[model samples]
Target: MAQFKPGERVEVSSNDRGFRGSWYAGTVVRREAKNTNRYVVEYDQLYEDGSGEKLLQETLDWIQLRPPPPPPEKKKVQFKFGDEVEAFYSDGWWEGAITGEHSGGKFAVFLQRL
Candidate 1:
């Protein structure tokens, strides 16, 4: 496992009694010492989204930290033209029909433009 860096997103243990379960998510605000595992995390309320208020900001060891999950993988588009697909778009996800395969994960989608 790589050393957690400041601004690195991670999950923090909420188990105050040192129980095996329970975790609260937060970002690594700062490193205590150079090349050390100490961190200061500003914790949020359990299950709180960005809109919710923060609960606690505390110093914890690296053992209490867990890396944030990897981003979701894009599904491979397997099409032979004229295939309907709900393709991801910059504006928003769109349901479009595949018109051509441009190779190497590229495809021409005839999107039903809004």
Candidate 2:
């Protein structure tokens, strides 16, 4: 029997030597015990927003699979100088471009209005 079971989340190790250290998180859609290292996996598209997509489905070696890393802690967005963004203030949301970075994650922006 395969170590990984159906519906398990796993990380696929890169097969290319040039990207030897890269890994991608995916869900085990199906698992096969007919031979060693066999499973079907579904993952999120590169541009999709957190939605899972089945991009690959083939029996692969078990050595290419591993547990995925913990989900990253939610972090505040940090805007850099010259980045176009919206800023909230006492009035409301304002369209602007970041002028400078402050000590905190705050940024100074030149508002289009006011």
Per-model clash counts, in order, read 0, 0
lDDT of 2 at 110: 79
The residue pairs found clashing in candidate 2 are none
Candidate 1 Cα outliers beyond 4 Å, as residue runs: 46-55, 71-114
Q: Per-residue lDDT for 21 in model 1?
A: 43
What TM-score would you give candidate 1 relative to the actual structure? 0.48
> Tens digit of lDDT per residue, candidate 2, span 64-113?
78776566569866567899875654323345789988885777887654
TM-score of the candidate numbered 2? 0.48
In order, the Cα lDDT scores of the candidates are: 0.67, 0.64
Q: Evaluated with lDDT, which candidate comes out highest?
A: 1
lDDT value for model 1: 0.67
lDDT of 1 by residue, 31-88 (tens): 8877477788876444334555644678888888888656767976357788876565
TM-score of each: 0.48, 0.48
Error of 2 at 23 (Å): 0.3
